[model samples]
Target chain A: MTATRRTTDTLVIVIVMLLVWQALHQVAGSTALPAPLPTMIYLMHAVASPRFAENTTTTALELAYALVLAYAIGLAIGVWMGAHRLSGVVGEPILVALYSLPKITLYPVVLLIFGLGISGKVAFGALHGILPVALLTMGAIRAIPPVYLRSARSLRLSPWQTIATVLLPATLPEIFTGLRIGFTVTLLGVLLGEMFASKSGLGFLIINDMSLAQSEDMVTVAIILFAFAAIANALLLWIEHKLHRRV
Target chain B: MTRVGAIRFAVIVGMIGALELACRLGLINHQTIIPPSEMASTLVTLLASGSLNADIARTLGEVMLVIGLSVVLGFAFGLVIHALPRVREALDPFFATYYAVPIFIFYPVLIAIFGLSAIPIVLIGVATAIVAMIIATLNGLDRVPPVLAKVARVHRLSPVTTALTLQLPAAAPYLFTGVKLSVSYGFIAVIAAEFILSPTGLGRDIADAYADFNNRRMYALILFLLIVATVVNGVLHALDMRWAERRSGGRS
Candidate 1:
């Protein structure tokens, strides 16, 4: 559990992964599955290219838009349902059902409604994100100790002041967990949308490379995405741990 | 049904009716979304005709295969890793970050390696689902009371017997949770892989229907998938809740 041991373990895992990659490349051939070293080199080149920058920016913009929509709508619904007991009773199961359902099945419907554009991708990504954010946020609010609200009332705080001082701080940690999960799923949703139908973005590039038999480029892009996701999750988890400790 | 259950049912029916009415009134475009009734009727006809029997069987079979493989293999891995404290500690971060990655992006690469067959689909599904089971197994094993081990020692039970007779039943609830998760994840991953790119399956059928602009067929297929997913998940969730309640009741 020590930092040094953890670091060493991580290094070992990385080496093991590289070995597996190399073994697969050997078995599958370089044309099908490029070696890790070559893929890393290709990744460096790909990252520097104009095409990479453009596609990354497009994906980033779509992700940003989707996150904004997800957070706004999710928080609104969560707060409402969490505060209103009747609505929560009526709506919670429905939301849970929708959340469990394979939402990818509905992507075509999203495409039909939003059309084959950035809007469709953004909407699909937001759709994946909204459920988790809303569910967790609602749980967070409902979990707030009754004493907190009573204390706020005793202080004669206004509704706005009560929410700001008591409710917000009480719920922030759990709500942030929701946001972290939402961030992950939204990225997935956006990638899926692009993979299925899109002219640009990292997902499109991946599919494009596959069709063109650009094995190295494809592997590079996948690795880049893998690294990005892993690093972001680590950062978020660190913050989450800190938040939990604070509370 | 209870009052809340009745109200929930009514709310769902009301929403479906509203959609049907909107379609009937031309308020919503039929091209974008068919009426719920029409989707149901089409699905019934689709089923009666048996045109999609093969696709349904294939997809469901793959899903079953995925669930079975993931649960067994994941539990095995979990057992091995749990016994190895150092390895488990190392793997904690990987497990935490696993689901955060868009794993489906590698489907194409898998296709390239495996030559665009069911192998890739099954592999991806297992990759997506197995982690949940492993984590669940770890959690379940962790929660098995230390006293259970002491009792096993007192009884002079072998390690295998202890695992089978004591650990398994105690951990059944959490293991079931893992199964529930694995089922959902397996279902989603398989369908998504098929949808993205595959020779044949429900996902492929939907994709093809969309491409051919067969809105009726597409909507029916989509509806079928949603219904199946919802029902399966509902059943698992209900079972999970029942087990959870029993566990709590026993504790109290």
Candidate 2:
């Protein structure tokens, strides 16, 4: 579709959805679901509020810290396991098992170990992301074509030289795929931590509003969170697309 | 066992033994880290009490329902989206971006509407899973070889007949991938929703254990969940490999 056509379609869909929302609210006649106009206005107010700002910053900071830890540790482990036959054999099954299992099961354990704080959230987020990153990175490295290896060997490239000039470039796409998933899972982990137990953050705000039956406030926070996730995903996707094009 | 399998088994055993030893030696707090031995005993106790059985049945039922509904709905939605190129193009970015968000945040709204029942839990699971299935189905459709379409044209097959006979079978592998993801991720979302806010199921048991400060039960439940997830994933993976082999054989 043309860009303009696509934009028009999206606009039409959004308008129709808003109309449906309003219709439902009117039909239900429930205070639980305020009208869309009011909800959007309330969302704007929530966004403009200093409290929401603080919460957004807090959640973003926690996510950043956790992603950094997850990326660094996961990358290192993936590289080591991928390159070494012994390590790969010993670690691949365990890592894959961990990756498949839901990491939310460990939230309470994290809370116990780290306590209910940003540290606990960060720990959970990192745990959530680390396995996927490590697994994907390992897979990417292991998938390097045998011909590439043979050529590298014939060229007599050192380990560092081979990694930098060949392996890194070859695996960049897969690595980015892993990173993208890692980033999203990290956000989920932090949100889980906040919801389960936390002093502050978007998760906490949403949960708190829900408990208090602040329907408008709850919806507003939810929208804000969705917007944040959407933006972050788009940004990462754009970067990945650029990298893929370059390669 | 294969050499790699044996090595991996040893690595797991070594880690468990190390953890047990650490707990026994008081290096690791038992309250925080319930050793595998204790967790096993707790699991046995729960089994004897029949609570574990009940929880397992409830959770399994909810997860199955969610996965079944999502798979059907998502595939249908995917087919419609694929048929309508304009709609697919328009909504592609939204779907892609939506996948990244933790849709669990919507559980509250679900609760308000469904009012603390299995409905909310199932809805949450389906919502989380359906998108992945839709994406996978679309991807599968896209992968149907152009030659198949040409062959269908040569046969003068109706579009519906062509899609049903030629395209869907060719896309089965990708569709199965979506099913696998939906099942696994749906399981996760359901359990998480239960854990977060629900009255029954394995999640409730875990949350109750947390409330009671029973580390053993908590660890036991987590361990059981891990085993279940691994088994489910393993089964799906085996089926996927078998399907690939059969599909290749059929082609040959």
Chain A vs native chain A, TM-score per candidate: 0.98, 0.91
Model 1 alpha-carbon miss at residue B63, Å: 0.4
Native contacts kept, each candidate = 0.76, 0.52
lDDT of 1 by residue, A178-228 (tens): 999999999999999999978999999998999888999888889899889
The local distance difference test score of each candidate is: 0.93, 0.87
Candidate 2 lDDT by residue in tens digits, B1-252? 988888778878999999999989999988889778999888889888986787799999999999999998998898889989988888886787777988989888767656788988999999999998999999999998889989999999997788789877889899999999999889999989988888899988888898899898899998889888999999998999899888799776
Q: Model 1 residue B209 lDDT?
A: 93
Model 1, runs deviating above 4 Å: B151-160, B250-252
lDDT of 1 by residue, B51-149 (tens): 999999999999999999999999888878987998999999889889999998999899888888899999999999999999999999999999999
Tell me, by TM-score, which candidate is best.
1
DockQ of 2: 0.61
State the DockQ of every prediction. Answer: 0.84, 0.61
